[model samples]
Target: MSSPPAVPVTLAEIARLAGVGRAAVSNWRRRHSTFPPRIGGTDVSPHFSLADVEEWLRSNKKLGKATSREWLWPRFEALGDRNETGLAIAVVGRLLAAGEGDDGGPDDVGSGAVRAAVELGQREGPSDILTFLLRRWLDTYVRQITTTPEPLADLMADLALWVRESIEGEPREDVVTVLDPACGVGHLLAAAATAVPAALNRPAALLGCDRDPVLTALSDVRLALLPRPGTLPPMPVIASGDSLRADPLIGTQADMVLCNPPSNERDWGYEDLATDARWVHGMPPRTEPELAWVQHCLARLRPGGSAVLLLPPTVAARKAGRRIRGSLLRTGALRAVVALPPGAAAPHSVSLHLWVLRRSVAGETPSGPEELLLVDAAARFPRSETRENGPEWSELGAFIRSVVGASGGRAAGGARNGATAEDADTTAWATVVPVIDLLDDEVDLTPGRHIMSAPGHAGPRLTDSWNEVRELLDGLQTERARLAALDLTSGAADQPNATVGELLRAGALSLRSGRHPTEAVAPEPQHARIPLLTLSDLLLDGSPSGWTNPDDAVVAEPGDVVVVGIAREFSAWVHEGPPMAVGPQVHVLRADPQVLDHWFLAGSLKAPANARHAGTHASSSSRIDVRRLQVRRLSLPEQQHYSEVFRHLAAFERLVERLGIVARKLGQDLGDELAAGRLAHGK
Candidate 1:
């Protein structure tokens, strides 16, 4: 019936359908005579007909007991193309929003995909279905699509709304309008839509524009499905086409704007739009596409309206954009420049910036001394095990609020005089530098530059430093004395050795690799509970910086040896506390106390010979083939003796490491205080 649905399924998808792994699917194709043949796709990733796979699965009783919603995704994903799939998803959203008995629904409601979507929508709510589908789609095309993370989107929305509230006072009856010119999948707009009504207690008219038609359609559907409080707001206006060239929403102005536009785009209509009117500051050079977006967002704002743009860090200090940066500062449009830590959003390795701007009302002069807030909140992020988890928003948000509040006070009145060195020290992370101070030849708007530590009074700080130094020196001497007592001697002894693979086969130890978190299932720092030990922690001998859900965790119990699977320097740690999750690129080796000593195994894994032999590459940076690593074959008594020596050596190494860290910190502090004339030599 219905021509077998003609949808293609990859081996991975087939494995998912059968509730098995890719290897199982491969085995089936090899061993089973009735297994489906490849209809299309490459040899590396062959595609099979979904109908054929389903028939074979049902005949063999291998089909997973999955709901209709689960089945809908693979079929939906197999649509004509990416754009078509996006459009189909959008159509499904529209159909879901239409509800039952709505004759106004799309005419193609009888289509299999549409029918399945309708059934799923009825079983679950329309909002949940759309959210589920969109999340999966985004996850599937993570590298291809550039959507803002929800937390970062929420932060941008909150920042814009808070700034608006601060400037305009109490909530007004007028409906606030918010615009995002490069809305992408409309995360920012959706965030703003939710935040504006809640904060302002009034309706919000949302506007969005993106170059992709499918994205525009999807955005419209997404905004429509959002649950609003009290009275319903007007339907959002999502326009298609490049906002820079075609100017879809040209004449529109909004109370607030939030955007995370594409960065470093070269052909963003520079030549054709040279004399365009949006360049209130100055014409942006071809290389400064982010600056163009900055001006565009500013232009879209109503007088005194606020905007927040997530931009690349280079936009703050690039030489080409210096003129525009200065103009924005001089005109008092640029309110603040906050530098977010790396992993805040896409391009996770580089620290991105949030440039907060406000449109100046006609004929408004500078109130008190004009100043711009510069906040470098990089250090404020919660201690994360990996860079991918991003910052803890609550702490970061509070820090920004405090900085902004302090800056507001400084703006009304001139900079405070007779401020103590302690007060100056506190402002090192956040400073409200005068606009005049920033209008130099470079006109660099980098937050780090303006927020550098200022010379402070050394009275109390110098006293504290002396106390710290004395304590560190005493501890260093104690560690050195302990090290001297060891009287260590090194010698090589030939012995029979067995590879880790042999040990595993002999049931001497159990080896398990850490599970890598998927984008959808990855634990956020806020939601995580169990401590997660990462490769960085293993290498540096530091405490756990990551966290994860206990159910998905690969926990290492006490006496288990955790080894870094990939590193320039091979290292291993003996777990000493409660069970903890091991993050990606880490291996947990649980040794049987009767067969092998945990300390001995850990120490053996860190040997230079093992590092070279197990490494896959000739260079220092290489992945370790843990199975290939050889361990000495020794009696249990001999192993215990070696373990004791290894344990003491490890403790001695840790002490030396601490001594080095403390000594360096004390040296830097003393050097800084003395050089700044805050401290004098004691007689």
Candidate 2:
């Protein structure tokens, strides 16, 4: 009556499903005579049915946790061979798409995975099961094979969709066609589909082609699941083939072409297909296969339609790609080249460039036939090691606008780091480079080279630097005097106090420590990413500086006192920003306004003596037992008075910090000017 023992799983998976170690599963196999016998797989990695293992573990009181769809994926992976594994996954996807009782059409051809798929469908429902399976596959297999990182996929999709919108200029149409020649798991298509309902023209037809059959199938299923408004578009057309070798949809031309094609592919039919018509721009060199993809994408677009392709920076400047690059620039097919930060995509540490291209029609010549837009957007990426390389959407949106809004090869522009008045005429970071300048001997289209060549505001005057230095000196003296006058000496020498743990037991304050960070899981992707407050981030800028997921950890609210675990001595800081998740080595204390002051708690806890007494730890893994630290007992008014003095001391610290920054910046600028013979000590 019941399904045949689910799917056969390996000992490792059994351990995972039971939330135990592999050794525990092995011990059970040896000690428990009633344990499931090997149903399949090698002696070293024997497999057992899920139903039998579950029953045995339950009877023996060893089943530790509930099994979910995540635990089921490893069963598919245990199917023995790599190709067989992929086939099993594909069979499952096909079975899911065919609906519960439909027998899975042609692709289902009957296998262990097929039967397991049906059983999974019955247990978890087709939609939920398939979503989890695909998500797990995306996190593992797809991530391993795909060139684009998950975040870059969203970015590329948005940019491509923007180009499509710009070209398809809206009044309102019920149907729109968009295509991706090399769609990988359909991330770009899925992102584009989310924009359909609000679009003036909804995406009625989605087309894609890829060389990998498995990915092509996955892409099809992923696109099919995207929510559609009113009526669904004709089921998406996803073909399996090298899009460049032979166009699968020969007569079809999409309004927009979005592609992140494989780069640096040497065997890209360059030698065999030397006379290919797609190379209308120029004959692509053997080393520069991305240019071939660029032309292929352009060929897929309707007249005046735009295409966005993700390419390597080498495509912009490599010697072999110059001819094709020059042809694109000369024909005005290439509109803009925006450089993204390194690590923007997986497997490539070098910066990537987004080449925005448009096909010219009878009456439409690009705004600047002799010029191209080049933007150095690498500045928008965070330099912190703990942060995700996901480009900020707002910043990317600004980049899109800047690229599209520029006219006559000129647009109002300014520096990313606050431009001076003199340099306000031309844009900062983004520039419009003339074609003639780019066509020189090397034909280097790298955005940095051209964008950085534009003149910036003149260096600071010697008199101005001297005047600012003198002003800082005056303020430094004033702050020093105020620091000396602080009345900390008036505090009671013998105050009654209790340990932080004791205060917490008496309901005077609440203490919480964050989850110790591990590499086990990642936060769900977020569009408006917020910086997580790590100990290093707190120490450096006194602000949250790394990405945080709202669901993953406890967040510190405005009045919480955050403490670092491994400080040289005890250290604490009052959080001042919006609520943010605290990192591993951090703890937060929320004080009761009536009983304790946050500044007072933080100041006393950060005191050197209190820090050392908490524990004597080694230099390698130092820590502070914050609960054992003592807090002074003071009435609300007295606490408020001392808190005010603490606030002044904090301000003094900040003033000194600013003084150092200004002094260093001034000296550096002066030294540079002096080296250039633009400044002297006398005047």
Candidate 3:
């Protein structure tokens, strides 16, 4: 019997293949009778046969130059099950790694997928192809997969390596082993392996274990394919099992451990492993599985070995884990707690903590009172409008390293003097707290509590606050004057109007909808080259907060008018900065300056009447039908005049918003300082 047809693709995929917006695809389906019919998927997101669609596109000369890697993803996705998709990817990895010919395999993955993988592998090589497929797969199931962000992973790896070097002195020439007990997709393990500096002359052996066999297989493939130095050790040892319960790497201690363990897991073998020897600190309470992972990491470390764990902030202050927290402090296992800004990882709303721990060496005792370094970087979180990736990881990482290094120097009673002037400046954020003080009733290790209470910590200045408020008031007054200068007069009774569709047909404007980045590819504040203006940015009237790849970006020029395609608060504005990628569900309209002014078009698109007539739903939030939106036809001079007025109005609104923010901050600062007796009214 003939093999079943290849996996169908969604409309979004077809649009991607055609190198056009989704709206363009929708238009083609509606206007062209020969458009392929939906073969599968729901009406909301219909899927079409890849063969039929490709044939149609080729016949119409609409197909874009797409790579084999791009074509292979849909077929792999067509496998219908996520498990099968993962298996198919893993099989491809194995085939490429083994350099085997594509014969039909026992796995349910179709022959077409295997063939496509072979073609992609030949063109891009094994490593590139596997990495691409893995990224796509992760993006496809982003909500389900929880991999560590790249910057955070690098920081964790660097911190672990630094701690190891500090405690053990010089790096050993032998193969240094690294372990990740909860290695999801091997990001942490891969990071650790690559983090070993070549100057150390030490090759790394990576060990990873996870509960999911599929993830374990993928991690194995990922680690196996990583470009290693010439001195690299054998393929990484990746195991499939619950690391906490089964202890797959039992009795196997590594020189360094890095893990982003699963948080808030009550069913993490708590009852069965009550008497587990790994619980050296204390039996982790049922509500505190993170504490269990912490102990497990410590247990698996060789003498003086270090582990860096990305944990939830709650673990530092939770009542249930106080005993374990105190014990860790007393034993000098937990060395530092660094508070990362929100959006550093999964569950983007809450700030996360990095717990740096080092297993004590045999016969080692505290030379003096033990100290726990606390770095509070939460206040350094980038504002919503600032284009930054979390915080500058390098600066933050260096600050943490300095504090830890200094503490180590002090503990060793070296010739190095105490905190320097620069260190004093950082005291507002980083402070070394006494472990004895932390072993209180609550045993709270929250970084903010200690950092804020540290001597010489600088609070907000009253003079600076008042000056900011004064500046805001002056700006607001200037904007109000500019807005008031706009001359207003009644217009003629009748005015001619044209719909956006008519303007498009008349060659007065070109319209395109923004493409959403794949689920796996998120916009970053730094590193990425193209700035992405998202829907939230539009609604909040803020600058672009993230960036994406240039290849996948639909850049809007300075004069283009961008409108929110779907929202309760519909808005349209003329872009005025550098070219930026327009995010998903945003309509970018480029007006021919000779025929239509961009500012006029933007202001007209925001007209309340247009929203009513062009909206697809009557609810508060609605999808805008851009083609149906009407714009009043006006002379170029009149358009320019109106544009000037609209510009001034927009400026006025921004000033008003800034004024409110400044006023509120000033009020809050005054109230807080006065209440705390830190400020007094002067005569």
Candidate 4:
């Protein structure tokens, strides 16, 4: 093989091979307890064999395989294996980091209010920023451990415990290996490794993979750092390369594979690799790479090996994709499908789905057209307010745990027998609806269909919610009517003014955009400091939010307002007193103090009329900021009104913010009660 890697690899060497930043290598060690041992028992500069660590990464390279099998079919896709060492180079060179923009901030439009938040966080006690960062980072570590959807950290940790329970219940005789193909930075791998001892009293066979060199390397560092019981392997297997195109660890069969593949890709690089091997079921449509990933994962596993994947609804019932669907059902590889909440995947707006696949038996056994085990998990999750960091993921994990533990409830419609003697004999509580109802046109996989969407509270029913919604709508309509009666067109509030649309067409005010910065972490300049507002720094409601850990390097000026054209989408909001500079992509509109009021500019940018001019948003790691934004115009008088409106809107938004905070408290408390069974009927 590769010449018995010298001694053990050094973390620095590993970091280089993995393509990560040096700091990231250290962070990986600090985060993962089971990282390779230090050469001299020194945590700092600890070293391990490159070959040994590479194997460890390969062992966990299950994720890469799943990703490969899904898109390329039979053919193996090779993603550039990477970690953080050379990440800076790749991000700068290949990714074209500037071509794409970030998704815009939170959807809510509380601009002035958000500005206040960023200012407050910046001005607040140092502890707030430090505490935020530490907690967030720790949560990220916990999330990596579970390798699950973006579940809340605590909930994901618990769900990981449940995964162990499910696997343990299956009666494993030896060490168990779990693979996550799209292991973004090794969340599931870390969890699988950690859970092995707790759930099955054995060491974990946690492994993972990804197409991005950055992610794979990051995964390596994360897996390397975990503390292991002396008996366990020192590192987790994490490799870089397209999991679908080529196998990182050829001739390896894993017991369990888990993943959340990218929803859809335009050029998954499939056109170049036709006539490949992985596609035993059928060729996947370019539009439906997810299907290929599903089949590829099935091909990778040994018989009786199980896998879980997050999917979109189309995989279940789309007519264009019926061939693979029919094949999977007839082959009986499909185990179960769980419907998740609509907004389950935050970064991606698509409705999320979960699918479980098991390899079919060789002989024509009792298993025939098996009905997939379907769990409508949409309504089971705790409300968003209660989700600690991310509630959607928290509830999803808990529900997954419950379903996995549930006994054989239903069989696919084509099964030879109604229920196998072994299955019928199980005592675990579960229900199995026939597959016929879930088939064909009836097969929409939204969780709302299968999962019971019952509210935990005993007091109110659906009718109450309906009434409240109506009441709220009625109140809003009344308020609108009242405002319409104000005769604003003739009043001082309403003047002969041009909309922001007109100003842009005429070019009275100036809209300038700064160049995109080459480096994300650059040395602080000793010039007049300006608040650099990336889309990320601003929350959806137009609040200037900071990372849990604050980066004091970027500051703001007095009238600096940020309009983000990142992955999140576009909207402009003024920063509070602290002056901030706009990121390179975000267009900075400089107005003479007399010409354009800062608040008015922010209001005009947010005005619904100007949204169309913002241009179509694209789907990429970075967002798109169109040049059109830099050419907008607005009259001085109209700008003044826009500014005034922002002032009033800001106050109302703050009130809503308080109400939300209170609501979140109630939701969290309610979740605790419900999950603990305190909210059960008659309790």
**Best model number under TM-score:** 3
**Error at 533, model 3, angstroms:** 9.9
The window of 10 residues in a row where model 4 has the poorest summed lDDT is: 72-81
Model 4: how far residue 70 lies from native, Å: 40
When 1 and 3 are scored with lDDT, the better candidate is 3
Q: What are the candidates' C-alpha RMSDs?
A: 7.0, 11.0, 6.2, 17.9
lDDT of 3 by residue, 181-213 (tens): 989888898777777644245778999999988
Total colliding residue pairs, candidate 1 = 2
**Which candidate has the highest lDDT of all?**
3
List of clashing residue pairs for candidate 3 = 139-520
Q: Score candidate 3 by TM-score against the native.
A: 0.77
Q: Write the per-residue lDDT of candidate 1 for residues 319-379, one digit (tens) a residue.
A: 9999999899888888888888766777665678999888887667854238888888764
Clashing pairs in 1: 385-545, 385-546
Q: Residue 434: error of model 2 in Å?
A: 3.1
Please give the distance, in angstroms, between residue 442's alpha carbon in candidate 1 and its true position after superposition: 0.7
| lDDT of all predictions | 0.77, 0.68, 0.78, 0.50
TM-scores for the candidates = 0.75, 0.61, 0.77, 0.50
Cα lDDT over the full model 2:
0.68
Question: In candidate 3, what residue range of length 10 has the lowest lDDT sum?
Answer: 411-420
